[model samples]
Target: MPKTYYGKYGIEVRTNEHNHKGQKAHVHVYIHGVEVGAFFLDGQLMVGNVKRKDRIAIEQLILSNRDEFQAMWDEFQKSAY
Candidate 1:
């Protein structure tokens, strides 16, 4: 997994090249090292729960770093073959 950390929050893009087939590009969120959930690049929560305020913050972070995240995802996908 490729991870980026922001203060107490962490974002990770898990490699799906050998498994998780059909899973969309997304990031797993963590707070204080605890997994919170997974979210799409658009900031939508794919699964799990988060406080409203935290969700908004997460959205902002994701949106601001969208390009970087997408690039990471693309690289990971390219290795699928």
Candidate 2:
């Protein structure tokens, strides 16, 4: 698992193995331990996890700093897999 900050909010990246039978790759996001949503692992707009209060901020960060977040995710994957 890995975590990052967007202003005062927190975003987490994590995966659950065997969560649903034959589930494809995906990542989950939580806001201060609240399950916001899960996204397909492809890192595309087809998947999004933005809450009402933080949606705009999260979207901007995700779009603007994708590389940094992706790098963090890569390291987490290395540790997990």
Task: Please give, for residues 1-81, the per-residue lDDT of candidate 2 as tens digits.
Answer: 456665565556553332443344444555666767655444443345565657655555566666665665555555533
Worst 10-residue lDDT window for candidate 1 reads: 14-23
Whole-model lDDT per candidate? 0.86, 0.54
Inter-residue clash pairs, candidate 2: none
Model 1 lDDT, full chain set: 0.86
In candidate 1, position 14 carries an lDDT of 75
Give the candidate number with the greatest TM-score: 1
Sliding window of 10 residues with minimal summed lDDT for model 2: 15-24
Listed in order, each prediction's TM-score against the native is 0.89, 0.52
Candidate 2 Cα outliers beyond 4 Å, as residue runs: 15-27, 39-53
Per-residue lDDT tens digits of candidate 1, residues 1-81? Answer: 778999989999877654375667788899999999989999999999999999999999998998998888878776744
Which ranges in model 1 have alpha carbons more than 4 Å from their true place? 17-19
